[model samples]
Target: MKADLKQIQSPIKSEMAEFELRFKDLMKSRVKLLDHIMNYIVRRKGKQMRPMFVFLSAGVCGDINDSTYRGAALIELLHTATLVHDDVVDDANYRRGFFSVNALWKNKIAVLVGDFLLSRGLLLSIDNDDFHLLKIVSNAVKEMAEGELLQIAKARKLDITEEVYYKIIRQKTASLMASCCSVGASSTASSPEIIEKMREFGEKVGMAFQIKDDLFDYGEEEIGKPVGIDIKEKKMTLPLIFALQKADWLEKRKIIHLIRNKSENKKAVNEVISFVKQSGGLEYAKEVMNRFYDEAMTILQDFPDSEYKESLSSLVTYSIQRKK
Candidate 1:
């Protein structure tokens, strides 16, 4: 059965509800403009997946407490900071179907807001002496920055290997999720070993989640981001990489040329999509995604059965199976 987020969050429903209130308090600012911007951000929040990961992992590892809430807020604040800055970097106007911080407030205001959020996250951790959670999330923030730079550098050359691709997504996407789980476990005073285990489990789920996102570029469904958006942006993903590896010299050159020179053209984008599909790229990518999913499930199996465990399992499933 397909897992809906509401059902998957049942175990931590109350905690998540409480989290929303605390998160708002944590983001409150004395400045009128900053307070207004923060309110806009709060109202347009997404599904709260990261906080759910934090609370659920805390539940599974130990007891949820004040520390757990702080940890969740820390992750959300830092993650939101990144997203706000990312909008400026991407010159993107929308996020989750709403006007982005930059779009509403301009790049200068958005940049300052991002910095504000980052500082808030840091202060929140330092004030509570939650250095362990701070370290975990800080490392993730570093990895994410490096990953974005690495992808940008590689995209220029169009020379990313399968190995490089994995490194990119692992650092970019998996690191944050890994930190979320580790923070959750650490907040409960779990042993380092268990915290490490949960981190690894989260990484595996993140790997699967990103691959599923890459697959969406091939028009897997009519929802999600538009098909070929990645290709149009000259961002090479798993399926495209796999197809290129299997192509003969001339075909490889031709496709690369199209991706580099004519990616914005609809016909060229369609052609690239056709080439990847014919190369069986989508099937190959799905196989790898499922492998990561299985690995995550195996890691989850190490913990005894509990409602938290079950909900975490469902959350993993929902990530890969989500329509958008």
Candidate 2:
């Protein structure tokens, strides 16, 4: 069953509200044009799941403080900047079912805004002497860029293995989540051992989260895009990768031809989805996601019981079961 986001967040509702204010204040700009764009971004913000992770992690480990708010600000700042740049790179007009920054402001302005946001995030850390926090976020940014480039490099051939797919998502998606947990622990002055454990826990949950998102490509629900958009984009997701591994040479070639040569074809996309479903690829992916979820839960078990700990567990459930 899917976990309710509102319920999962109830534990930190007040802290999240404070974090929202801090996030907005951090994005404030002297230039009117930049301020307008920042306002738009704030209005259209999604769940703010990253900040929620930070606050919850802090609450579980120690207590929320000024440092916790700063950590949340840094994560959201970098995360938003990346999304804007990603829209320009992917030529995507929509994000979270709304117009992307690139679509509304043009690529030049969008790119500049992204750069400004990134610089602000870095400066926020440096100015406050949060060098340790800077190191964690800087590494996540580096990993995300490498992960994206790797995926694009392999897109032409559509030749990603299960191991390679894990590596890509770890860098592209899990790195940020890991940062959230690490930053949260650090903000509360948790020991190095505890911080490492939280980081690993966040990484595992993030891995499961991405796989769950991949599963939605084959789901019947109408998410922001048409079904099998990943197929249309020739992206190699877990189910398709597993299906290919199980197919004979001739069948494998046929499937690859559809993905590589006829991905735009509605019939081909439907056929590929059907093939993956029939091959038990979806089931296999779900099992993998569950394994990660369970591992994350085990890590949390080492922490003492508290309302915050239960909420963090609920977050793990929410990550895998979220429809969007």
User: lDDT per prediction?
Assistant: 0.95, 0.91
Query: Considering only N, C-alpha and C atoms within 3 Å, which residue pairs clash in candidate 1?
Result: none
What lDDT would candidate 2 get against the real structure?
0.91
lDDT of 1 by residue, 1-324 (tens): 887899999999999999999999988899999999999999999999999999999999999999999999999999999999999999999999999999999999999999999999999999999999999999999999999999999989899999999999999999999999999999999998999999999999999999999998999877998899899988989999999999999999999999999999999999999999999999999999999999999999999899999999999999988888
Cα lDDT for residue 44, model 1? 95
lDDT of 2 by residue, 203-286 (tens): 998899888888889974566356899999989999999999999999999999999999999999999999999999999999
Name the candidate that leads on TM-score: 1
Query: How large an RMSD does model 2 have?
Result: 1.2
Instruction: Give the clash count for each candidate.
Output: 0, 0
